[model samples]
Target: MITAAVLAALAMACAMGAWRLTFAKWPWRAPRAAILLWQSLGVTWGLASVGALLAYALEPYGGGVVYGLHAFVDSAVSFGTGHGLLKPYDLPRVSALIAGLTLLAVLVTVLLAAGVQTLRARRRHRVLLALIAHEDPGVPGVRVVDHPGAAAYCLPGLMGSEVVVSAGTLSLLHPDELTAVLAHEAAHARERHDLVLLPFTALNWALPWLSVVRNAHSSVALLVEMAADDRARRYCSPRRLATALLRFGTAGAVPAPDGALGASGEHVMARVNRLVKPGPTFPRHARVSVITFSILLSASAPLLWIYPA
Candidate 1:
């Protein structure tokens, strides 16, 4: 039970830290590293929370969570034969076991459900695009949809991902700006940013009462955009990207379609400002320290779960 208490406390701390991180400015300087930290925090919190309940519930079986669970299961299997018998579970322990299992089930169910919904939406959009969109020689690999509203997004897929731009965006942006926008969308497709957002979406659905989860979702999303911008800068000058973002912000741009990654979505003005007056890069030592700590923190959850108590 002491180990369970410690795991619960760790989960609480992670939750509080996630909430505070949403407002921190350091993430803007090293969005990639910050994203890693965010993922670690979220994973650790979930693992520790579930581990706490299971640890407490299985405490009477001795050893750690895994061994205790194995012992419990073995005893249950041999109950009728009166072989490998263990003491019966009290009401509190039984309740804790059920609750832990239920929570685990809910998390897994929501995660899978979110993935399926996203896949279905993407498939629908892909079919629609195939029928209505046409390739433009000027843009090479990009598909141009004949729409008046400014739009730029990527439909990520396993076979082949595609970047799409509306006719209005082509009309509004200069050639260099167009290149930057395409690069931005390409970064999203190449990096599979949609996958990064999936767990957070599932977490939010599973735990809507926790405002921290919602804030983390929004913050991670903005970081993903910033990370994509960083990648886009590798292909085109920041100035061109900044101008394109400004146009998108001011031109009443259409939001990205469902299950698609947008080039000019999620705090466009903030992205533009970032490009216009870029901040100092995070120190290498600081980034290394953060990454190392995050990895250790994530590892701790499983270690705690399996360590003999």
Candidate 2:
């Protein structure tokens, strides 16, 4: 029971931390590291919550949750008594076990469902693109759509990724701006940003009413765009990308297709500001500290399950 309480406290703390981190400005400077922290908090919250329930369920069987669970299951299967597992099972413990397993199943089911849905959406969009979009001699690898609205995005696929731009985008931007947009979209493909955003998307879909989930999804989405922008910066000047983003923002360009990552998606102004007037990135010490904390946080839930009270 003590272990269960500690695990529950840790889960609540993670949720509070996530809520606070959503409003922090430091993350904008170190998007990648911030993303790691967010992922850690989310995963830890889920694991610890489930661990707390399991701990409560297996408390009568001595040992830790992991060992006790094993003993309990073995006793149930073998109809033998050992490791203090001979005690009659109570209603509360059985209920806790059922609840914990249900929650775990729900989480896994939603995540997998989200992934499948997203893949299907991407595939449908890709097929649509194939029928209407065409290749340009000048933009060798890119697919050019004849739509009048300005848009640029990448479709991530198992076979190969596609970077796409609209006709209006070709006419609206200068050559340098176009290059920057292409670089940004290419970065999304190279880095597989879609996968990075998948978990948050799943969480959001699973718990749409939770503000923390929405914040996590929104913040992570913004961070992904910023990360892609950083990668694009390696190829072109920051001003070029910033200007292109500004154009996209002002033009009210059509957003990328569902399940696709756009160059100018989510909080475009903030991304441009970061690129135009760069802020200080996380220092080596701070970066190391964040990485270490993330590792510890992720491991804490499992450790609680394995170690006796």
Candidate 3:
């Protein structure tokens, strides 16, 4: 009933915020918290859907909610498995469960497809790279490819992951600048930003026409880059990192290799601007509050159905 409307409203709010964030640069002011918020938004949408369905199913039942819920679940189980006929009052729960189950399956399938697609693309790139790339001990933990253009990206895998920089890029940057680039790529690999990007990829696949899907992907991608920049800035000079990005920006978008995240994948100007005019980081309390809100918001949806008390 009312909770169903509340769930729908929360989902819409998250979607609207995601769409608006795509056009806004305020999130970069505190990249870590922003990334967490994006994650929460994604989780909130899925949970709210389930909650809405549950609230709708429960709306027709009154008195002895505990016993009604038991009957509802029993009916749902029987309907789902084709075992028994449902009482008219129990039909809503059975239908709701079926819809919720279908939604869950589709979500899971999309994510699995995205992950497989990414891994396959990366495997193909890695195979091609093995033939043309050479190991450069100078960079320590990365590989160097003698390509014409300046493209730097990381290939992550189950056994081993490789961070690759083109020869043109190596020759273009100063020593410190090169390290900054490495640090940024390393951050991506270390944090498994690929996994973080997976849900957005799935969303885009499942909802190609929805602007919210595209906006969420774009916003999430930039946040990942900004998070990496912050990590690199910890060990390297912010100016050096900014310089590398500026240089990469001039080198033109070296389209991040398929399935891999490149140093300059679109948002080059926004990233450079951020480094140039460093934004204020989220304070300790502020970060805690953001995280707390995310946890509660995400939990609210599931809690409404599971433990309504």
Candidate 4:
């Protein structure tokens, strides 16, 4: 079926081309668009993976995978709705259904597992924050630990998110630079960047050997830092943010704490370059077109199920 072929092709392309898609220079001008496109790619890649397997199993469907699936579902629904008799599925159909359902269930299980693990990590880090970190009224809700290195990161939760920084890190920056750093860290917590990265993390767990998963994980991580930078930029000067990055980030290397994301969490050089270069605005039409393409391509997998082959 065209749908099956398309899904296969999409999976292959994503597996092969995710790096180019995520690391393109054009995204600098359209960070939000790039974020959407990346999110869509991550979601569709998983679905396409399962759909591609089901496509092979449904080979016995003369009208192609989608057609047989469509007809089978129609029959099941008809029987359930009491509009028709329940026709027993043939062995091949039963096998295909079981295989398809199993794959889908596995995908779901992976996602849920990723979510649970991330939450557990966040909870543990939050416990550490409460125990070792002290609340500073000057910084308001932020937690400051008396560590030697200049580090700033956040433990995110729905109600009890904590923005953490080292006391030595505080000593290294000007007040404005500190403000910029806090804004950047807050952006991570406020926007819930970890959740955005979760699906890719799950994919990587599911397919650790796949280069696309590794590339996507790192690329999405960098893009999220950029996204946080974009948020920080709204509150502070890019120069100050870049300056903070230079001193606290480069030599100091304030690493992201366990399960928590950091200001300098990914693509340090690339992120610094972005802050320093401050590239020109990308054309609105180009961003729109790319976003549209991403949406349609991501939607195609599900749409395939909606339409018959």
Best by lDDT: 1
Candidate 3: tens digits of C-alpha lDDT, residues 1-309: 676678878878888877776776667877777788888889889767766665666655532223346766786689889996554356666687567667778888899999999989998998898899898878876788887788888888878778999988988899999999999999999998988889988988898898888888888998999999999999899889998988887877477777898888677778888888886765788778878987887787666555442
lDDT of candidate model 4 versus the reference: 0.78
**Which pairs, if any, clash in model 2?**
none
Q: How accurate is candidate 1 locally (lDDT)?
A: 0.91
**Ordered list by lDDT, greatest first:** 1, 2, 3, 4
lDDT of 4 at 185: 88
With candidate 4 superimposed using the best TM-score fit, by how many Å does residue 229's alpha carbon deviate from the native? 0.9
| TM-score, prediction 2 | 0.93
**How high is each candidate's TM-score?**
0.96, 0.93, 0.87, 0.85
Poorest stretch of ten by lDDT in candidate 2: 79-88
In candidate 2, position 280 carries an lDDT of 76
> Which ten residues in a row are the worst by lDDT in model 4?
85-94
Cα-based lDDT at residue 162, candidate 2: 95
- Highest TM-score: which candidate? 1
lDDT of all the models against the reference?
0.91, 0.90, 0.80, 0.78
**Positional deviation of residue 24's Cα in model 4 after best superposition, in angstroms:** 2.0
RMSD of each: 1.4, 2.4, 3.3, 3.9
lDDT of 2 by residue, 1-309 (tens): 899999999999999999999999988888888889998998999989888988898888868789987877777766654333443288988999888889889999999999999999998998899899999998889999998889999999889899999999999899999999999999899988898899899999999999999999999999989988988899999999999999998899898888899987778889989999998767988988998999999999989989785
